[model samples]
Target chain A: MRNIFIIFKRELKSYFNNPLAYVLIIIFSLLSMGLTFVIGDFLKMNDASLTSFFFFHPWIYMIFGPAIGMRLWSEEHRMGTTELLLTMPISAWQAIVGKFLAACVVLAAALLSTISIVFTVYYLGKPDGQMIVSGYIGSFLVGASSIAITCAISAFTRNQISCLLVAVAVCFVLVLAGFPRVTEFLRPNFPALADIGNSVSFWWHQSEMARGIIRLQSPVYLLSLIGFSLYLTGVIIRGKRS
Target chain B: MIDIANLTKHFGPKVAVDNLSLSVQKGQVLGFLGPNGAGKSTAMRMITGYLPPTSGSIVIGGIDMLEDPNAAKALIGYLPESAPLYQDMTVEGFLSFAAELRGLDGQRRRDAVGNALATCFLEGVRRQSIDTLSKGYRHRTCLAQAIIHDPEVLILDEPTDGLDPNQKDVVRNLIRHMGKTKAIIFSTHILEEVEACCTRAVIIDRGKVVADGTPDHLKRHAARAGSVTVRFQNAPGGLRQDLEKLKYGARLEAVETAGSTLSAVVYPKTKADASNLSAEIYELARSRNLALSELHEEPGRLDEMFRELTSQNKV
Candidate 1:
């Protein structure tokens, strides 16, 4: 556990020390704020919920999350540091968890910067702040899910492009799986498949949270997703070290 | 403190290490010598618990590597061949992270990092980002990270590979100093380094050990039947007979015509006997009215031992 924290601290510090992180966070904040105020209002239907702000997160994280995760294990493997890490006193699991947590912390910081949208909506209209809070909760769950999957995908290849492409493709399917159109098409043709898809989709579970309903099932879904991704990452890291 | 038995690693159809087994005593500086692609790195990785062996067992400091890798790894400090490091981290930060990973904390971690830096001569670069440092400094950083926890066994794969002459000397001296107390295993192709630093070595080629001994022990094993070259101006036949008759408790094989000179292998049963036999041959050549133009000993070097070991085992 201490080893994991050590790795986590190092990985998190890498973000601040490396210059590329400044550009990424700046771009991330501008996009989240701009899309929430400028673009969400353009597409608003006068709803008193923070549905606009939460909706843009999945799309935003699809790009940013993968970019943040692409370097986690891929760079270690590329630089041959995987041996150094594996041979250290720490186990493979500790390092993976540490790195995952580091990426999560950095992603959380980036996510927190978008709170300006919350304040903007709070003052601009009589929005249900509870629903907005839940909606942010849902946004966080989705980000966690995507980042977990991205970290797993990043381990499959050393090239950042392949890591990003795989992460985006996997997250894209999960993001769209619960959409009404996707469920409608599969409902009659393959009802069981649709049922399975709806259960796994990010939005299907996220919708309840967006409306200020914190279903026990929502956290479970996100936790399970993150856990499974972390397990897969463990396997990849073990395979790589061998 | 280290025991390995039948260690093997396979990558698909190719075998990286083939039933390799060896042991190292406490405070023994064991040099791992091999040609490229000869399983030296693979063996080191398996012992360090970085890579699992396809078959066989590694027991380091009384802990089984496969059974409990964490405890086994806890006993080892490994410096990989390329010395992988985080470019964004400073020397202090990198070593602190390594020390913490090894289960140190607070003042202990700080002191361990400081001591490691001193061992690797990295005090000046403590605050410098590893990327901004020279290759030698980066290499020392790698070495320091490995030993930060002060493990009983230290495995280094080409620890001094990229350093210049002076930096090499520093690392060599450090290893020599460290080896006085801990078990050390290091790999390098530089035979002179092995000769200068190691107590014993295992020369491997094509995934098998061909020679294992001290430097002089290996040199003696690889020496061809000690040869004595006799360049004569006249009477080659008489010289040959005279040389053949003067064998006193030594086995001499005479080559009749070796490049316009009669070259013969004076196979003294022992290398210690070869020196005395050379003078005996010189007198014989002189007594026969033959000008002993050239009478010299064969080239026996540590490198020759390495080549002979590797070349013969090449698959």
Candidate 2:
């Protein structure tokens, strides 16, 4: 546990030390803010709820999550630092969790910085505080799972561009699985596949939490996604230990 | 202390290290000598518990690396061939991170980082980010990170590879200082490094150890254990044949002429009996009433021995 914190602190410091962290945050903020105001007509809605802001998180993270996770292991392998890291006393699991949680902290900070949107909604009208909090929680989980998937793919290849492309493609599929058009299209020809897609979709579970439902299974489903992705990442990293 | 036995590593159908075995005791600086692709780095990785061997055992400080990697690794400080480093980190920060990863905390971590900085002469650039430093400084930073914990066993692969002459000397001195109390195994293709600091040396070729001994012992493996060179005032005809027939306690392996000078190299039947060949040659020249211009014996050459032992085309 202590070793994990040591790695986590180093990784977190590295993110802030590099220009990538600020660049990622700026891109995420611009895209999310732009999607909410321009596309969702957030200001014209006149409603206090941040539905537009919360709705764009999956798409925003699809770009920024891979941006953050692409360098997690790919850069290590490329720079030969993997040899230094694996030879240390810490286990592979500690290194994985440390890097993962450090990335989560960065995502959390970016997400929390959008509290200005909450303030705007509050000043305009009375918003359901419960739904807004639940929406933030859902967005956080979705962002974490996206980062996990990106990290898993990053571990398999030393090229950061390849990692980003493959992660974006897979996340696109996972995101589309929950869309109404994809589900409706699959329902007529592939009923079982459609059911599986809907059940495993990121948006399907996130929507329940965004609506303030807070079902036990929704968080469980997201947690399982995180666990499964991280497990696969661990396996891939262990496969090339030292 | 480190003990490795029958270590073998295979990348699919290709073998990297083949049935390699060696032991490094405390206070021993074993120089691992090999050309590129000779499995020097692979063997070091296995000894440090980073790579699992295909079939072998590594015992570090009495802890088997395969069975208990963490404990074994805790005792080892490794500097890989590339001097792996995070370029974004400052020297102090990176060394501190390494110290923390080695389980040091608070004041202990501070002291370890400080000691490493002082030892590696990195105090001036401790606050400088690694990427901005010169290549020599980056190499020193990597060395500092490796010794931050002061482990009992040190496995360094090509530690002084990219450094200038001064930096190389500093690193060599540091290795010699550390070798007093720790078991250190460093690999380098540079022959001078083995002669300069290594108490014992192992020359590996094609994943197997071809020779292992002290510097002098390995030097004697040269084709000519020792030689006597004499420049005669008068260039005698058939001088080469006469020198070869002198019956010096050892066989005259080669007699050559260079600019009216004659030099004959003698090889003892065994390395132990190479004592009086030069003296015998001098007495023979005196008895023949041949006034000598120059009479000197050349000890074995390490580079020649290395080339001969590790030559790739040897049968």
Candidate 3:
């Protein structure tokens, strides 16, 4: 546990030590708020809720997740620091979890920066506080899931650009899996395929939580996805050592 | 403090480190020498537990690496070939991280980092970020990271590589000084480094132990070892013929006569003492009334022995 914390502290500090983390947070904040009010039609909706803000999270995280997590393992391999890190007394799992959590914290900071939108809704009128909390939770889970997938992809390659590109493509597929149009198209010819796609889709689970439903399966699905991807990351790293 | 037996590693079908075995006791500096692609780095990686061996056992301080790697690794300080470091981190921050990973904390961690910086001569750049530092400082920072915890076993892969002559001398002296209590294994193709620092040297070729002995012992394996050279101002008629017929358990390998000055090198027929052979030649020269300028025995060369041991043709 102490080893994990030590690694986590270093990984997190590394992110902030450069301009990347600050730039990423600023961009994510601006994009999410801009999309919510402009493309999302938040003011036009005339509703006392953050529905428009929550709706754009999955899309914003598609880029933010990979950008934040892409360098986690890829940079280590590129700099040849994996030999120094893996040779330490800590287990591979500890290092993986440490880095994963560090990225998650960065994602959380980006998500929390959008709390101004919640204050706007509260000032305009009374909104369902529970539902708003659930919406933020759902957005974080979506971001965490994307970051986890990016971590696994980063472990597979030593190039940060390739890691970012490949992770974006994978997250694109996951978001599109249950996209309303794609699901509608598949529902006519392959109804069962549509159900299966929705079952594994990040969009579907996150949308459920954003609706204030908070089903047990929603958090479970996203958590399990993060768990499985982190497990795969450990496997790839250990394979490299041998 | 390190006992490795039959260590092997196979990258797919290609054998990177074959069935190699070596051990180092406390207070011994073992210089690992080999030509390029001789598996020196691969062997060091396995010994440090950075790469798992295909089939072998590594016992560090009596702790089995395979069965309990964390405990075994805790006792080892490894500097990889490239001396990798987090380029964005300050020298102090990096050393603190390494100390923390080694289980040091609070005052102990601070003290360890400080001691490492002082020991590696990195106190001048403690607050400087790694990427901004020069190559020599970067290498020393990585080295400081290894010794922060003051591990019992130090495994350095080409620690002095890419350094200037002055830097190399400083590092070599540091290794010799630290070898008093720690078991150190350092790899280098530079033969003189082995002579300068190693108490014992092991030469590997094609993933196998080709030669292993003290520096002097390995030098004796050179072809020219136990040979004598004689330089005379005045040449004697039939000097080569007389020297060949004298038969003092030696053979006249070559003789050069240059404008009244004659020089000859005599090789011992067997592994006899070069002094004994030279004494016999001295007697013959004195009897022949020859004016000899210089006469001495060659101590042999490490480069010759290295070439002979690691040559591809040698089985």
Candidate 4:
């Protein structure tokens, strides 16, 4: 446990030390806030909930999560530091947890920077605080899931670009899984998938959070996905050691 | 103590390590000598628990490596070929992280980190980021992290691979000082390195042991049946035949002369004595007005022995 925290702290500090973290935060804030108001002020989807804030999660995560998680292990392998870390007294699971937690810290920080969007909507009208809080929570959970899955995938290759591409492709599939027109196309051939449709989708769960509904099943799905992906990362890392 | 028995590693069809068996006692420095791709690094990695052996048992300090890998690993300090470091971190930050990973804290951690920094001569770069440091400083930082916990065993795979002469001397002295308490296993192709640092050496070739002993033992082995060539200032017409018939040599391979210089290789008999051989050659040449340009015994070459051992396996 102590070893895990030691690795975690070092990994988190490494993020802050890198300029990419700051760059990503600034760019993500601009993109999230910029896209929300451009559509809100133009389309006038005036509502009490954070429909605009939570609507952009699926698209935002497609690029943001992969960029943050691509170098989790691929860079380590390229630098030849994997041998040193594996030879230490820590277990495979400890390394996975440390890296996953470090990515989460960055994910949380990036999520926090978007809080300005909440104030922008709150001053415009009396938006429900509960719904906004739920949306943020949901957005954070969805980002957690994306980063976790991408981090596991990053361990499969030593090239950071390959990791990023694969992660974006995977997240893209999960995003398209929830669209209404996509489900309508699925309803004729695959009724089960259509029934599970967008409901089992990331956007579906995130919508529930955005509308101030903190359902237990939503977190269960996200947590389990993150947990299983992290388990896979541990196995992949242990395979690389030999 | 470190014990490895019947260790073998296979990468697909290529056998990296084949039935390697060795042991290192406390306070003993074993120099693992081999040519490139001779399984030195593979064996070191397995011993350090970085790679698992296909069929073998490794026990470090009474802890079974396969069962309690963490405990066994905690007893060792390993430095791979390239010192893997977080370049964004400063020397002190990196050392502190290493100390924390090894479960050290408070004053003892500080003292250990400080001692290791001072021991490796890294105090000057303590506050500098590793990226801005020189290659020598980066390597020293890697070494400092390895020994921060003062493990019972140190496995260094070419620890001095990239250092200059002056830095090599410093690291060599540090390793020698540390060897007084810990068992050190260092793999290197530098023959003089074994002479300066190792108490004993094991030469592995083609994934097998070819020679194992002290430097002096190897030297003496090479010294047997030594040959010497004689050059004369003036011509000694029958000196070659007379010396050959003196009975020190089983056969004389050749006798050549160019401008009154003579040279021959006398293949000494198994029971021939060096003193008799020298005296007989000297007498044969003196009576013929030969000045004896050169007539001295050859010093042993451990480097040649190493080359011969590895080449034999290569063939």
Flag clash pairs in model 1. Answer: none
Worst-scoring 10-residue span by lDDT in model 1 chain A: A42-51
What is the per-residue lDDT of model 4 for residues A68-136, given as tens digits with 9 covering 90 to 100?
999889988887888888888988788888988998889888888988777767777888888788888
Model 3 lDDT per residue over A1-242, tens place: 99899999999999988899999999999999999898989888888888778887888888999999999999999999999999999999999999999999999888888889989999998899988989989889999999999999999899999999999999989988988988999999999999988988888877778888889988999999999999999999988777
lDDT (Cα, tens digit) per residue for candidate 1, span A159-235: 88889898988878987888789999999989998888888988777777877888898889889999999999999
**Largest TM-score belongs to which candidate?**
3
DockQ of candidate 4 is: 0.69
Interface RMSD of each: 1.2, 1.5, 0.7, 1.1
In model 3, what lDDT does residue A27 have?
A: 97
Q: In what order do the candidates fall by lDDT, top score first?
A: 3, 2, 4, 1
Clashing pairs in 3: none
After superposing candidate 2, which stretches have Cα over 4 Å from the reference? B233-242, B249-262, B285-293
True lDDT of residue B105, candidate 3: 86
True contacts kept of each: 0.83, 0.85, 0.92, 0.74
Off by over 4 Å in 1: A42-45, B228-241, B248-265, B269-299, B313-315
Model 2, B12-76: lDDT tens per residue? 88889999999999999999998788899999999987888999999999999988899999999
Better of 2 and 4 by DockQ: 2
Span of 10 residues, lowest total lDDT, candidate 2 chain A:
A199-208
Candidate 4 deviant stretches above 4 angstroms: A40-43, A196-200, B220-225, B228-242, B245-267, B271-299, B313-315
Question: Who wins the DockQ comparison?
Answer: 3
lDDT of 4 by residue, B27-116 (tens): 889899999999999999999998989899999999999999999999999998788888788999999888887878999899989999
